[model samples]
Target: MTLLYEPERFKDESRTKRSKRQLLLTKAEEIFRTQGIASTSMIDIAKIAGVERRTLYNYYNNKEEMAIDIQIEYLRNYGATVEFKINHDLDYTKQLESYCDTYIKRFLNNKNYIIFITQFDYHFRHFSMDDNLDRYHKIMKDRNMTNNPAMEIIALICKQKELNVDDQLIRKFFFTLHHCILGVAQRVIFRESVFIEEQDYSSEDIQILIPILVNGIVSTLPSYQK
Candidate 1:
């Protein structure tokens, strides 16, 4: 049976088609996980996805493009699963705590993603990519992050928690979070920093470590006007 086209269901045809393409990317990922990329072929993904080789080609020019697509999907999944959480309904400290706790947990769960992500053909293309592709996406996201519904709520938090704080620091703090993730991923890939499997580590250790890091930064920065 086709994974996407259920026997009985109706929805937006365009959305269904988009999902069908995404399903192919997931199938491609599973194949990579099971057989390893070196042994996997485009034919293997096509067979796994129940799509013809020609159909796969329509979405991606070849395996390199397909690999990039799978990495993109992985990053999107992580963002959806682990990205920031801000609750305007809650008071500032409580909401910040919730967001910090959730983001750290998400990061902890994603420890192994760096290993696979580094293998993608063009995962770091943002800094290296031609302006035509990367710039547009960055600009769109930057605008959204500053003005989106979520940020509007976060703005409320800023007003409540750091009533006298500079708004630029609020933005810079979020940028620091992004930098931390990139730093962590880099160390994970290089096997440079503290690691879970090294000499001694546990989930509890990480739980403790994250809160210390979060609260330390929040406290020392003097950003919290209260």
Candidate 2:
């Protein structure tokens, strides 16, 4: 059976419904990222999107619904970029380089995005920005189009013989990867809070730092099960 997708479902073109959905989503993202989810109201997004308050609700049930949709879109967008780069590059280090560069660049350059994350507190509430993580996980049960961006890249690295790692071990490696990246960034950029007590780490140092961290974590995990 052939799959069918309306031409209007794609990114560009002239379609009011699709366009409004995109506009509403984009506005919600901006509001959430700048003012934070808890602080942002549907009316705020409506004002930003140039739509009526009721129109915002017409698109989303509430702030949580909008937050889930926007956050899910961000994660999927990040994953798609990573997937394209991973599939294009053969060298494992090259893939890792692509992954690391994209990850750091996107987050570090976006200040309002950073403020939202820090304000929402991702560590304490991983589900804060996203209440639909379980839904996403279910979609990714067979490694669907939606999976964590960082994990997607690691899967590509594991495919190469030089990386010499098994698929089963990548999850543990990914957890370490996640915290290492976050910890390094917080240690460098936000020195006023929890980081105030922690030692300072420069971004330059992380280029050398991450490899050591990944290698240690990857090596500690057991080899592929028999």
Candidate 3:
């Protein structure tokens, strides 16, 4: 007699494995934020995650790989949320506002992630030469071409308004918007003295800042002026 296998059992096992992996990644992220990546060992992550050292290695080969995975996961989740907000807003200007508002709120709410992103260049250097790291970065860059919310917003404005502006100019406009958001987010995250004298900035401050930069961009667009 031949034995048979159930597909449902295999599906359940796959889901269980994914849950375990996500749990481990969440625990490791907390440790990375509190202890800093350089000082954190795989042992530390396993201890904090309340899992065996062997089990941790079963999911991630090393701390560097795990950290990169965590960062990529964060980006994927964040991008999806922003895309949802932009997609729902039918008006072009409303979509732009949603983009700015969502980004500001998300960054402000996730201070740890903001801190990680602000120091990403330094942290990434540790694994810069790794093939996996380089390959993942290339893949993400390619993926961003269609999935990027800011780029989609610009394209929508140009298409909906029938603007005759050069493509390069529209790209430059998006770059400016990107820089403005990142610059403010870094300043708010670090509490830079030049941007804010206080130890913190409120959501209200960010709400005010978004419109100013976004409107400035709109004012410069040929479609807006006409």
Model 1 TM: 0.58
- The window of 10 residues in a row where model 2 has the poorest summed lDDT is 1-10
Off by over 4 Å in 1: 1-20, 32-44, 47-52, 71-77, 80-91, 108-118, 121-143, 147-164, 181-197, 202-204, 223-226
Q: Can you give the TM-score per candidate against the true fold?
A: 0.58, 0.60, 0.71
Q: Flag the better candidate by TM-score, 1 or 2.
A: 2
Q: What are the lDDT scores of the predictions, listed in order?
A: 0.54, 0.57, 0.67
The best candidate by lDDT is 3
Name model 2 segments beyond 4 Å from true.
1-14, 80-106, 109-134, 140-166, 186-205, 218-226
Off by over 4 Å in 3: 1-13, 84-95, 126-128, 144-163, 190-200, 222-226
Q: Supply the global lDDT for candidate 1.
A: 0.54
Per-residue accuracy of model 2 over 72-91 as CA lDDT, tens digit each: 45444433234334454366
Q: How do all the candidates rank in terms of lDDT, highest first?
A: 3, 2, 1
Question: Model 3: which residue pairs collide?
Answer: none
Candidate 1 C-alpha lDDT tens digits along 1-226? 1123221222444776667766876787666654655567889889999999999887665555555555544555555233555554666555555665675566566654554554443333432343333533553364445643323434565555555556676666666654564555544543524565674544434344445545555565554664
